[model samples]
Target chain A: MGIALILVSTLAAGVPLRLDLVLPDHARRGKAVPITLRLSNPGPEPATVYLQGRPTAFDIVITRADGTPVWRRLDRAVISSILQVRVLPPGQAIEFTERWSQQDDRGQAVPVGEYRVTGVLPTDPPSELRTQTVRLRILP
Target chain B: MRTPTPVQALAAGTLILAAACSDGNEPTAPSNETPSAAMQGANQGAPDDPIALARGVPGFGGFYLDAAGKPVVYLKSAAHRARAEQALTPFLRSQGLAPSQLRVLPGRYDWTQLEDWFSRASAGVLAIPGAVFVDANEASNRVTIGVQQGSFARIRGIVERLGIPPEAIEFQETMPVRLLATLRGRVRPVVGGLQINFPGFLCTLGFNAVRNGQRSFITNSHCTNHQGGVESTPYYQPSQNIAPARVATEVSDPVYSQSKTGCPPGYRCRFSDASRAAYTSATTSTLGRIAKTAGPNNGSITISGNFNVTAEGSASVGQVVGKVGRTTGWTAGKVTNTCVNVAVSGTNLGQLCQTLVSARSGAGDSGAPVFKGSSNVTLVGILWGGIVNPNGSSTTFVYSPMANIERELGALTTF
Candidate 1:
């Protein structure tokens, strides 16, 4: 089995799956924060989904209160040759976590402010897998 | 809580065995020994501990903590898994962590291997049309090749001939590359990314630098010596119509000058296309900041305020960097290639290692200051020139990495 399979299981097709973003309410500046995505299958049948692009399909975007994007994980250059396909059974939730270095997309220290982090699980039909916006406050 | 399966138990046992065998030449630790609290506390504060340690170990591509909080180190080949596991398990144990905390995963290429592949590709395979930049993507253990439309087939043929597996190479369609040059366009107090008039043309000011107590501003050497001849020149702010404010003492080594001819055999050779201008005291002002704008990528955006630059540093592949140049103002882009050796026509610069940014820059933007993307920016590089698409939409801006610039000029960024 490939490393992706060992890390995250694939989901079956045609089964309704919901994505949930999980993060801390408050984080300190210059600290490492982990953002996780929970993909749950609420349907009775198993669902299969392809995690296209790079090793993982999750993207984290940080934007200011006015919706101006400050940073985005997917915006950086990535190796797009490797693709992953995962299958998830009913009532099964697979989580993928990525750590943020408390810096903006440009590798600079982010100012202390209220920001919104959106976790996106890009799928074929687009908008099929998206988590609720998580509010995070950066403390000095 | 989930119980450990038989396979998991066997894996844990293997980790313990690997840890014990890591230092076979050294005396084995007594099983009854207990770790000190101070040692455990210190280990707890090891920032990104596994990844930091793995970077020093050869064949280790990358690492991340699994869902179970186990450090999984990705190795280039399964053949080296035992060696990696043995090397890392002992370190984990020394850090007061269990041997099972370390897991070895297999990857197609390691960091050094990917770098070597890119170095070769940049010199040969990447010469094909549509191939804009070649860089290593260590996070995914693959070499990313940027190509324009209609070049994928040609690039694939080269990749096959190079014997690189399809899975190890990634191709992305990008705008055609072009060098940013124009006969146009700042500051000790005057600021960076602004216009600096020199002799016949203008270029962007990079940053305030100092060497042996002498103050100066760095800019593209080509701006000081446009005809490929090394000569000192006077620089003016705003425009040459203004009073001459500084004199450039050191134009970069003439184009195609190799460091190998001067340095010993074991020393690595470097090439630079940067020059420095000494302040004339007529203008006793300097600020360690780059001009920033409010809107992102809007050419019409105005300079909002200066982005504070605390120090200078090197940039990594895939890192997002921002630049403020006279023509483009404030623009941000991802670094596509680092350590690239390319030739710039007319400038007579050849085989200089440059950092490639995926942003459009114009002719006058040469010598502009490149900074990290953040509210508090740090000096990253100095823009020299880049390839602008035929239609003039996008550009592959090339720059001299700040580390290389500092070494070549023996100057340190003051701000």
Candidate 2:
């Protein structure tokens, strides 16, 4: 099993405003899964953006191979009302990352198995901004 | 038809950059297009409702007034001018109206037939592969269809299949319309100075306010439908059809009161162009913080920080103040006029005791919050309309003073 966790960052081209997710090919079990989120401006022009409150706006969900929900980032956590706005220059990016332990919302860790992970940057006035689900393996 | 109202007051909706007006007549224009003198005329069209005139005249197709304020009616043929005038005499304001005053023009089709073709074309226009949009152009008295140039022949065949008369439709070359790119425009805990979308218009929020335990935000009265007596008009943040976008419902938009004291005999008058929309959720919006952008609008705009409100006060002529709006971003200017009587042209309504600022603003900026600070400032007023030249852009922006806003909306806590 591997020991390090890494996720590559990328910026989409052509599209004016985009939020992309980055994850390393695959990671070993028992190690913390480092996930990265970036709100990028791929278009040539600068953009004025209003973001949903931070930390709260970023979410992740882990599921079984067959698509059953396992753990969600925002389940019972109370979210405070927060509104944020910032200007993004062309070709630039902003990042929000979270390290997820191999465990679910509950403190218990799962047995060695294959799972799928998805990231979401639910900006306000929500858009079709979700990361493609990636397969993962938690080695015993 | 230019009203003799002050130059600064007629273009008052310049409260916005895209210049959205909060007066009952605003956002009547598309919320995103730049507020231009021509656009205002197009939105308000002729004050006389020609469609209403088309109601009875046999084969009548259109109606309009000449520059001299005389009525010019359109009929299926010049032969019907005498009969048409006889038919219209009962309903029209015929006094002082010379027989030559009721001029009649030739039209190709009957208004009824055009209406039927419009309905059929509307349901079938988009079915044509290259068709972009459809409209019942009353002035031309025909169903106007916008389609790609190369696809005209294909659309013509498709139009025949849809059973719409070929002679009744005018095909024009045009490209498809697209939605604005707005990934960063949506806000949670909805803040002031951002765009707000309604059925067919976009406007800016003024400021978060609280009156007697109720939480809400202020925009222009025109931002709503102006059908008073209910909190019915719903607004969405950034745009419609998105989750968690419903931000507020109009709660207060009082009808304009008329008086010889401050208003013309036919025009309506009000203390402020302000109105309130209660937040849909208790925690859906934030109070006193307005979005700030680094510079003027240059196509791609971005928010920098916010001008946090600290107190509430008034400004005198020559005193500088600033406002942030969806179209123009953040811009400021000196107080040009402390108070003046402003007339909203299209609506035949006037605002009394309003303030004017010589600031750079545009369409969709209506309902922007006007204040007197850079980062920390005192709440002063809410932007509504503007004053512009007959064929020029607006140079002065107008607003409802905080004192007048409170007087019209009742006491509210804005900071």
Candidate 3:
């Protein structure tokens, strides 16, 4: 450990970090879609937050309008056992971007359809944090 | 652990993927680390200086600098004045002083006696949770025990049972101190004070080293899946998914000792909170170098790898020290107490003979390297835990001393 500055925010100060998913509204079939997750500390005070892993630490799901699952990231992938925690200063943000290759978990190209992408951050207590869902449309 | 459940169409688990780890926080510049004038002439006597220069003249008393920075050597009797002046000559002249400027006074107790009481009372007092520190207060001629607010009675009872006379001991209430481990970002050919990840947790890598022709790095044993077990748990830089490859594996993590030799009541003891991970190739590691952050408060940019560690030694009380971690880049403070037996709350662990520093530390700073020089460094210890502020940062922290590190991990050539 070299140097660290913990803003030392209280739990009453709310969650120390904020999380969100960033993706395009639509992508053409067979083309890779970039999935970005941003974790930031918007501080009036310092906060301690955790992310299980980078992109792998989150469960990114793409489902149809009818709630039928289209594809899932980490659906059967081995989640690395390591956990990461950061007591971040306010205004500090870390972003992770991964490519979703338009294919389903089974390696099949998805048919053009309306879809929604959501992310979940699972912590040790088993209380999972879910991001607001974003809509996506796959083109033929 | 963000793993997945395949049965559910929308998995509710975690996965490990590599992401470019970056720190968005600004860091504070660390103060230069040098012996404070008040702490000069410590036990490390130059061949020319008397061994008791600052620690006091044993039966006479101790030495200190007055408000104007002049040397003050206190004694128990006017008869010792000549000896005190003679002992302070070379050190005084070196500071551009004549023996005429030396101040002498009759002190209440011999420093040697107070130091003995401190040593005798530390482990037992620290065994009580909330007993933050045990210090030898030179000016007060008493052994000071800093107890957290609610822990006073518990600490007082233990100290009383240890047979220290009430007049010779002092108590002060303190705030909560938390264990700290911190760091972030992926740096190739990793260095100390960077983020290293293990299953279910993350911590800072202390230093890169070599043992028996293999490269290795040290981190807090608590960062491992098991604190003192050779589980061979793999480690990753910054985060595991970045390359999905481990930087090293736990090779040695000494079991907590069952014997109570250094332990207080009801605790298993370990000399250091350290664990070593073996690197398979020399190409993936470097030795004696810590990840250098931009000078103080600017630790967000860690590309420079020039902070050099030239030697390993014990940190004396009152010396300044610094550390780097993934979370808080660079923070520095003074070494307040030495050889304190620290108990980690919520665990059965008692770290014996640890050093305490008042610095800015936070979660994820575990295993951070602590050095004593500002321009360069003399490696002293590794960050393990601290008393955290309400905001989650540490104002006073604890680390395993170099001697203790070697006690359990064997002799190491850590420059």
Candidate 4:
């Protein structure tokens, strides 16, 4: 198994951005909210990360502390996100830019307390080995 | 003038065993001492030494009886051989066997002729009688012999036709050799990290070696441009597919899909309790004990307690028990009644059964070690088959005989 490293040299204006989980720091059950992740690459090489799904090709996931999946979307949406970041190089970094709303097919918000996010990424230098788990959490 | 001497008697007995038990053609046993031997005994050297050339030839085939009387087979080969050195290479290198160890017929088209060239190879020799194809015209040509593993047993038919004495040929067993050259210092892949052998996927499987200093074990023929490496799955896949989805996709609806496949060729799926937890309790207890036992046997660290086994065991069915595996460990089992057939594979291969005192074979256990428990645990079978795919409904089981596997393994690892 490989490990992915994140180096944050500068942030909002040169202040290194902190990589942490953001969510219902404390929220009511059944409330739809978004989680944000801070990103940085302090090394000379850019990093390309992929959010690998669970069990199958179509299931990218970020589960709650209790093991319940917090990210909800049709299979198509997951595939779309995958195709979006198909390419990324070293030394480059993306911010807490992407937004995702949590809700079920019935449009009902998911019951949650704490959540985690995980996926896959290529960590080898000079090699673009793909597919990995990216794990993170949201405190609501 | 005299009864057969002790040496002659021994040679004859060896010939009989080889001829009667071989999975190949039967050859007439030669005299204990060749005609040349008599001349050498008389004059110390002979001019018409047919036995010299015949003995010089190598004997190549798979699945032979080793010195220990256990079946063995060689899993390695060499590309070059000198005519003079070919005859005695196998014996000298692996098992320290000699020309007298095997008996080949004299007249052309005899086992002696084939053995002349294949027998000697320090690296290893896979002895399987070359298949003989006899056309309508009765012109016989050599066809290839196919055994689950390369062994003499697979060539029994060929040996019989070539008139090769069976006793002379023996099986070799491979000692576990080191195979971690490529894996030694290479960067370890994360659970989902993917990297091409960007350099080269020589070989990744590692084993302990005896003779040669630990070296990477790679087969020339099994290599392709980009096909090499290890995967997270239980089955032994080519090197190219080691990553997660980028390589192998989980069988869709693994449970349902595997279950449907378990049904008969044309039958409907039937989810039965027999396929579920009938022996779960027994299995849990058995595995718990076995996992502790594995430490002494060099098993992987994490032996799962939740592995599956069959529930249907009958009394004295002489079931050829073993595991179908990628990691290549197999054992023998007996039919214990009051048992049920567990879903060994994902499909309808219900032949895989669970035993109480046996071993716990898991994912990599496809070829786990199995042995008979009737008396003491004697190595009796090889695990070769089971449902590759399994469904909650029904799983299939497939197995190869331990005798066959042992026979082949014997030939390869004798040294």
> TM-score rank, highest first?
3, 2, 1, 4
What does chain B score (TM) in every candidate?
Answer: 0.50, 0.54, 0.54, 0.20
Regions more than 4 Å wrong, model 3? A1-140, B1-183, B297-301, B389-393
Candidate 1 lDDT by residue in tens digits, A7-86: 12233445567777777878888888777777787778877665433234457778888888788765532211112335
Docking class of 3: incorrect
- Candidate 2 A-chain TM? 0.78
Per-residue lDDT for B376 in model 2? 86
Which candidate, 2 or 4, would have the higher lDDT against the true structure? 2
> For candidate 2, what is the DockQ-based docking class?
incorrect
Could you say which candidate leads in DockQ? 3
Q: What is the TM-score of each candidate against the true structure?
A: 0.39, 0.42, 0.44, 0.24
Task: Give the range where candidate 1 chain B is weakest over 10 consecutive residues by summed lDDT.
Answer: B1-10
- Which ranking of candidates, highest DockQ first? 3, 4, 1, 2
Superposed by TM-score, candidate 3 places the C-alpha of residue B218 at a distance from the truth, in angstroms, of 1.0
B380 Cα displacement, candidate 1 (Å): 1.0
Model 1: per-residue Cα lDDT at residue A46: 73
CA RMSD per model (angstroms): 28.3, 26.9, 26.4, 21.5
lDDT, candidate 1, B233-314, per-residue tens = 7777756565454534544444434453443233333466577777776666465876666644676325666778887787
Docking class of 1: incorrect
| Cα error, candidate 2, residue B193 (Å) | 0.5
Over the true interface, candidate 4 deviates by an RMSD, in Å, of 15.2
lDDT of 2 by residue, B28-82 (tens): 1111223344323333322245455344556677655566876666566565565
Instruction: Report model 2's interface C-alpha RMSD after superposition on the true interface residues.
Output: 19.3
Task: Give the candidate order by descending lDDT.
Answer: 3, 2, 1, 4
lDDT for each candidate structure: 0.61, 0.65, 0.66, 0.27
lDDT at B376 for candidate 3? 72
